[model samples]
Target: MTVKTFKQGVFLPHYKKYSEDQPITTIDLPNEVVIPLHQHIGAPCQALVRAGDRVKTGQKIGESAAFVSAAIHASVDGTVTAVEPRPYFTGTNVESVVIEVDPEQKEPVWPEQDLSSLDKDAIKAAIKEAGIVGMGGAAFPTHVKLSASKPIDAVIINACECEPFLTCDHRLLIEATAALVEGARLIRKVVDAPRVYFGVETNKADGIAALKQAIKDDETMEVVMLDVKYPQGSEKQLIKAVMDREVPPGKLPLDVGAIVQNVSTAIAIYEACRYKKPLYERVLTLSGDAAARPGNIRVRVGTPIGHIIEQCGGFKGASGEEARLNKLVGKIIMGGPMTGWAQSRLDIPIVKGTSGILIFSPAMVAKTEHRACVRCGRCVEHCPMFLYPSHIGMYAENGRYDSAVEWGAMDCFECGICVYVCPSNRPIVKFVRETKRHVAAARAAKAK
Candidate 1:
């Protein structure tokens, strides 16, 4: 049987060998953690703890009045050090609660319940209290996803970690297969879905096998192997790959009678529903050419990037700005190379959505300047949404955001495919992002 995939996607280096087989390692508890209040897609959370206050692990320290937002919890039992604006992975400073860990640590314990007896509202309340969000970089509130108004018929577990140099999902599937399947079932129950599908890429053979063995006895669940291609893990693409459903433009997965959740996110749901564990920590990949040791590690939310690198053995080769040649040209990405944000500082705290921390040396960094598009149409050919990226990019660059909007800039997900394949080194994704921001501002102004 042929594996299913969405059209117009690209194939790139998997870059998984460095840490694919490395079992998940736990980072030593840091003295301080900077928990950002706005980790999810919706409204920012309000701090519940002030300086000098004490907090416990898994305690809710931040919450919002908004229904779309997820709560924030403490990862360590510590005293509140401060609550201030701090740098986050998205290149912006967010209001964060800083905690100084106590000298003596106490093992964090949560409520353990019989999941079979819980109703849908109870499960959703547990998940919302746990601060569960999409761990695959979207950071959308999982409780909101579970409470969709539309009737769902199928749920797709996006196990296709197609991004290069990232294997946290693969490692999780191998290590926590039972939990993931249980989490998927929990989601099915919440949405009242009849069928569940694990859409895994062909490259993740071990993950697929492990999940199959775990769910083989379940009649409603099926494991579907997807094409080993880029963007195959995207929600729309995964829905198409597994269920042959195409979500119409300007719509959502709920519109097509389907819902998708990340593999790690599913594990989180299981942990939350069964053990009443809040999402205070998550598994992430730390790798790249500059990394001294490449591996997957479970880390506390709000831990500094610099601390994580030190525990992983720091950078490869030399140290300091003088010895590091890439200091001028290289970048440290907060996620996969294709869609990750380039970071200028190492002090930012990790969030629930952070999947990988990839480092690039000067040699590995792409060297290119802004140049005119050759109009080879490579961007259009590789675009999963089939939009004219060149036109949007040019219009955005020329400050003609209206034209860019007309060219369907808002439809672009900034997958970085056009930028990756551009011969002229055009920062197409960046331009599209700027245009979208402008369009959004215009819409907001008009609405007022």
Candidate 2:
């Protein structure tokens, strides 16, 4: 079925050709991995192991008491080298467990299990025990997402792959169709949703076709092709497109009687249910002009970006020579260029949220200066949430925290569309984020 299109969305340059056609390959274990204790949205997990302690794959190393938080597992069989603070993607240094791989260690194996006889509760238990989270950037615990307290009319499987140069979801939809479907069934049973819908952007025709074939025998499952646009895969946006339901501000999909899960998260659910394997590895797209062999590789969570690039035939041109000869000016980014974070160091290990590792050569990295807002209304026009970014920016600049919140700054999805279309490059998203932080702090203080 063809899904309905939304009113506002932008079509940015998609540099996906770099690795779209290439199949996913697996990268060998790295010599060392830095496992941050805090990789999810809630409170950071406390360390369960100390330095110099031996660990095996799937062993839980970090756990938290917060109900919203998820657990962290050891990605490789190795010795804990350190249990100290380190640079994490959250823009702050946090305590992490660093493991040095035992090169002679054999590949980890999963314990045999019978899943065909298990029920929905067993599946949820397996997912929670395995520490699985959303792999499509949100990093929310999968078990929590699948377990909804309210009634769910339908379940939406997000396969849009809207961001540029990231084909991890697309490849998974193509290769792991059966697993995704089974995971969707499990989610349906858990949420008690009678119907399931798979939403994919039209750009991924192959994926849509594969999913359709996989669900052909299932009468309750339907595949809907969405208009190709940025942020199409976002929960609220996709819900609107596929189900024509508007999730009110500050409300979750459950409130509107829907639940969304990513394709990779579904695959992880299947593995957890059928094989009892924790989410220690994931498919990551290694691409850009700096890479010699651009493609997707199934990399262990702790595998370093430097090692992944080397396995992908190393960097290309002067970047390659400089990387091989001496450290250079090229920038490395995690996830899509639009919403992804630029890394100052390449030694950071791949976390569960990582979908792609983009290597931009010095020449390709554009360092644009921030300018004032031009009031062109492009940001407003392109915002998926239809909020006034100009007003939010002005309020943020004037330090009017209350006014910014009143102007619906919290509704901003931070999809970077405002930052992308601003002619003056005013970094509107950054200001909105700051305003959100201030507002959140104020609310917290008020609660006290």
Candidate 3:
């Protein structure tokens, strides 16, 4: 069978071998956790617990009245040590709730809700209370997705963990197949979608099989095999591949009467509605050449990257020994190499959207200086958004931020294909970032 796929996405090397087959292992609770209040895409949460307050596991510690935000919960029974600004993965300081875990832990109990009797409003309320967001890195509130304005007929469960070197979703599919399938059904019920499409890349044969077997004999859902391509798991591409629907530019999936969701988010929704569990922890990939031990890890929301590395046996060459993955280290990216942010340090805590951490040796880092863009159309040819990346990038680099937007810089999804194939090693994604920042700043100034 020919798998469906979106056009123009690059077929780069799939680097998921390190942890793709490794079963997930749980990390021990860290001594302290620094959970940010602004983990999602919308308004930041306000501190609900003050310093010196004792909190239980799954307790809400940060909350916002804003409809676009989700609550923050304590992952462990602990004492609030501080509610102060701390370093975040995106290179900004965010107000965070720092907790000191209690030496003795207790099994936590949550208020229960009957899933069969809950209405759509009640279900949405439960999702919001669970603090669930798009665990696939977008971090948008899940309840908002369920509250789509359009009447959706199809809901896509994006199991296409398309980013290179990230395989936590694959592990989830193999290990928790039933949970994921049931979760998809729960999601469909919430949105009243007629059918659910579980989209998986053809590369994940095991995941595809597991999902197929799990959804067998079920008429509400079907397993869709997608092509092997980078960014195929992206919401826009996933929708196109599974439903043959093109979301018009400047629109969303709801515009096409469809809603795309990360497989992890569905599982979280299931846990919340069934067991009344809050999303204080998540499963993420801890792979790459840099770590001494690379595997999938189930980590709490506020655990620091430094502790994660220590549990994984530290960086490739921590003991003054030259390990293969760490000869002249160049950059430590916090997510996948293609779209992840370069981390200045490892003190940042894991957030809901963190999918994987990557370490690149100097050999892998681009050493060539950013040069003038040649008229080559590689960026345009490879762009998934069909925008002139080079033109918008040049406009941004030249400080013509408005012109960059005029050239469709806003349309760029920062997939890094332009930067990947550029012969001159131009930082097209960086320009896109800058262009967006400037455009936002301009909007704010005008509003003020």
Instruction: List the global CA lDDT of all models.
Output: 0.91, 0.85, 0.87
**Clash pairs (backbone) in predicted model 2:** none
**In candidate 1, what are the lDDT values of residues 52-160, reduced to their tens digit?**
9999999999999999999999999999999999998877789999999887879887668899998899999989999999999999999998889999999999999
**Per-model TM values vs. the true structure:** 0.97, 0.95, 0.97
Query: For model 3, how does the per-residue alpha-carbon lDDT over 1-448 read when each residue is reduced to its tens digit?
Result: 8699999989978889989989989978899999999999898999999999999989999899999999999988999999999999988899999999999989777666677887777778889999999999889999888888779999899999998889999999999898888788778888889999999999899998888888789888898899989889998888888898999889999999898888889899888987889999999888776667889999999999878877888777763234433454567777788899988676889999999877666776778798898888998899999999989988888899889999888888899998998998889999999988888888999999
Q: Who is ahead in lDDT, 1 or 2?
A: 1
In Å, residue 75's CA in model 2 sits off its true spot by: 0.6
Clashing pairs in model 1? Answer: none
Best by TM-score: 1
Name the lDDT of candidate 3. Answer: 0.87
Per-residue lDDT, model 2, residue 406, is 88
Q: Please name the candidate that would achieve the greatest lDDT relative to the true structure.
A: 1
| Rank order (by TM-score, best first) | 1, 3, 2
For candidate 3, the per-residue lDDT at 411 reads: 80
